[model samples]
Target: MAALAREELALHKLHTAEHYVSKAGLRETTDQIMEAISGVKAAVDNMTLRVDRIVENQAKLRTTRS
Candidate 1:
């Protein structure tokens, strides 16, 4: 009976440790995904600014031609 109790306690501790390790891994993954998303958003914003500048320049050229 004492051996069985000791085994059960060890199993419970192992499971708890595994749970925390899994959560830590999940948190790291989530952080990496968020960083990637931020990078993409920055790229898109930069592209938008470039397009706006092109459109403005085109408009200026049209007015000058008229």
Candidate 2:
């Protein structure tokens, strides 16, 4: 009976440790995903600014040509 109790206690500790490790892994994955999303957003914003400048330049050229 005493041996069985020891075995149960060991298993419980192992299970708890696994839970914490899993949680940490999930958190790390979420952080990486958020970082990637931020990079994409910054790239899109840069593209938008470049497009706006091009449009403005084209408009100015048209006026000068006229």
Candidate 3:
């Protein structure tokens, strides 16, 4: 029947649209996760830099005292 065929076509189109929307949402979530990881990496790098400076200063003090 023509009516049944038309209904099936509509449902197929709706299903396809839903698939694309879900894919886009997944991409957005992945991007947010990557951004958060980047932020944590930056923070860790800053701490490492500070610790290096502290160690260097201590080494210099030890040499001066000797």
Candidate 4:
């Protein structure tokens, strides 16, 4: 499930980045550039949450074993 979610999120990021780039005027459009940065921030956030879940599961397994 996590793998699938990660793949989907990755795809979304790719599409979003492309869309931002296509709209951003070269040497201009600071606002669009900032928006692109925000998009990347969101992607990072999504990946971080996924990693946190994986770490939590590992901790639970360790406790269960001991």
lDDT of each: 0.95, 0.95, 0.95, 0.90
What are the C-alpha RMSDs, in order, of all predicted structures? 3.1, 3.3, 3.4, 21.9
lDDT of 1 by residue, 26-62 (tens): 8999999999999999999999999999999999999
- Residue runs of model 1 more than 4 Å from their true location after superposition: 1-21
Better candidate number, 1 or 3, judged by TM-score: 1
Off by over 4 Å in 2: 1-21
Better of 1 and 4 by TM-score: 1
**Residue-by-residue lDDT tens digits, candidate 2, 1-66:** 999999999999999887766768889999999999999999999999999999999999999999
In candidate 1, what residue range of length 10 has the lowest lDDT sum?
A: 17-26
Q: Which residue pairs collide in model 2, if any?
A: none
TM-score of each: 0.68, 0.65, 0.68, 0.56
Report, for all candidates in order, the number of backbone clashes.
0, 0, 0, 0
RMSD of 4: 21.9
Model 3: clashing residue pairs? none
Model 2: lDDT equals 0.95
Compute the lDDT of residue 64 as modeled in candidate 1: 100
